[model samples]
Target: MLRLSRLTDYATAALGWMAERPERIVSVADIAQALHLEAATVAKVLRALVQAGVVESFRGATGGYRLSRPPAQINLVTIVEALEGPLGMTDCAAGAACEHALHCGVSAPWQRISAVVAATLSRMSLADLARPVAQRRHKEIA
Candidate 1:
């Protein structure tokens, strides 16, 4: 099944936490406690996200982490790619040339499907995720 890794899930959670308070710099410990996650794991995930430019780290007592850009500017595709590399629906669909590349009919179709899935993910921005659940609930009720 297509799914994000635990690290990816944590990265998204961390970013979503920051998005909730875009102006505040949240320390790793605080975030871990709030999210009920392990600090070490969150730290590792944050480091990866930092390298991806998804988050910016600060130093000093008041230093912590914050989103590098507006939520609207980020997307699931970029975040997932940052945490897990490219999204692929099949093993051979992962940009690696196969010996049966020319003889395979299923690989081509799978590749096309993967492309569509990736494109759909690319079209959804983090802003969509940042929408408060209460707001979504209200919309649903309406």
Candidate 2:
């Protein structure tokens, strides 16, 4: 099963919390405390986000992090790609060097599936993920 790494998961949680206070400069400690996460982990997550242009970091006594853009503009793919790199769902997804590269039966189908997944992620934003679980629902897959 494909799943995001724990670091990426923490990044989404930290980002979702920050999205709630988009204008505020949030310390890693504060976010960690509020989200019941580790300060070091949050710090690391924020660093990746900053590098990805997903969030901005401030420096000074009051230095912290804030969303570089509105939550609606920062989509899930941006976050996932920030720490995890592009979404390559399979060994054959990215023209990766593999024995299967030559006439692989599943390569084309899997790449198509990966594209659809990426498109879905593009439509999902940080704001959407920030909603409470009870307030968020998904249609059943047909």
Candidate 3:
């Protein structure tokens, strides 16, 4: 039952929208309107992204937000971590102390699985998410 939070999902959608128009400075209101999400939610997501250095914010009247780097340079791992803190399949996998740590034999396996998940996410860049399905498949096939 592993899943991303609703806010994280919105953040990805917002980021993907921006990635498609990387050269544009997009207002939060516009993003909210386009994504049919609440303005406050979009603002919150943008603030987190800005704090994480995933997106840069402009503070002028005509200012808005844009990605801090190219889509290809930003991976899902970075985005997920930025939105969700860190990817961990279990408490121990995230380095938290567990009451059963001494007796836990599955901890090592959980850590390994977490590492593989992290690596898979790292390999998937924002550019991949931004592209059309056909384009992504073509790239994967080539």
User: Best candidate, lDDT-wise?
Assistant: 3
lDDT values for all models: 0.84, 0.87, 0.91
Ten residues in a row with the worst lDDT in model 3?
129-138
lDDT of 1 at 124: 82
lDDT of 1 by residue, 68-104 (tens): 8888888788888888886888778878778888888
Could you tell me the TM-score of candidate 3? 0.91
TM-score of each: 0.86, 0.89, 0.91
Which regions of candidate 3 are displaced past 4 Å? 133-142
Superior candidate under TM-score, 1 versus 2:
2
lDDT digits (tens) for residues 1-142 of candidate 3: 9998998999999998898788899999999998999999999999999998999999999999999999999999888988888788998998888999999899999999999999999999998988884476568999
**Most accurate candidate by TM-score:** 3
- Considering only N, C-alpha and C atoms within 3 Å, which residue pairs clash in candidate 1? none
Backbone clash tally for model 3? Answer: 0
